[model samples]
Target: MSDTAIRVTGRCRCEKNPVRFEYTKVPAEVHYCLCTDCTDISGGAMALIAVVERSTFRITQGESKIHNYDTKPTCHRRFCSECGCHMFLYVDAFPEHLLIHVPTLDRGQDIGAKPDRYVFVNSKLAWLTLPDDGLPRHQGWANSGAPVEV
Candidate 1:
């Protein structure tokens, strides 16, 4: 990671009108999530999320235009109301982290880490074949050799 803060922002699909936000500093890691909650809420086979410290994220613009929904009792997802772009989410499992959808980052910005792993493989869509990449695939969260299970 570089000493300079890594910043990113993005708009909804309608490039004409957009809701934007920006964040700084390096993210912990990026991961591909295939959990049902992710797929259902994002309306996609998988969702790519950059996990950054919550305190480092902020809505620089369109604060009033963003809306949220609790996909589950413990998961609060935020999106642009107009274009309906899923932006970020706060998960109870990791309260200190903000899960920013990779698609929401400005096109030219450096999004920090490449995906280090694929998560929730057990729930991946039946028709979707994961790439033959070498990244670790975890049924749940990666163990990271942590003594305490998350």
Candidate 2:
């Protein structure tokens, strides 16, 4: 599909004044994040994230209903005020991009990309076993320059 024609829509859990968002291009990167902050806040084993350019993303609705919480000094997570569903986050380390929770996207439509690797494996819970997906597993951030043994 043409770059400008490609669009993906997603929303928070709220039925009213839900936080709606859309992106016009394929994400730059997609990965499974095993960071403690992501897993703890999401209440999940890991977070599937799609890194998209800020210029291609837009909040279509519930702008006022979106609440931001600084998970840390560098990470500002935005969620729906009503449902408290975390939708996206801005990281100081990637100023030009936004990290979106993959599950927030409407099902049945292509997410425009596939997760290529796993990040923060160093912080992965010991009880959680990773799938034998053959994706590169990074010990830290994907670009952290740390060696991947598996």
Top candidate (TM-score): 2
Looking at model 2, which ten-residue stretch has the lowest summed lDDT?
Answer: 141-150
Q: Deviation in angstroms for 3 in model 2?
A: 4.5
lDDT by candidate, in order shown: 0.81, 0.90
Candidate 1, residues 46-145: lDDT per residue as tens digits? 9999999888888777678788999899999988888888889999889899998998787876776688888888787789988877777888766533
In angstroms, give how far residue 46 of model 2 lies from its true place: 0.4
lDDT value for model 1: 0.81
Question: What does each candidate score in C-alpha RMSD?
Answer: 3.6, 1.5
Task: Please write out the lDDT profile of model 2 over residues 41-138, one tens digit for every residue.
Answer: 99999999999999999999889999999999989999888899999999998999999999998888888899999998998888999998888888
Candidate 1 residue 85 Cα shift, in angstroms, is 1.2
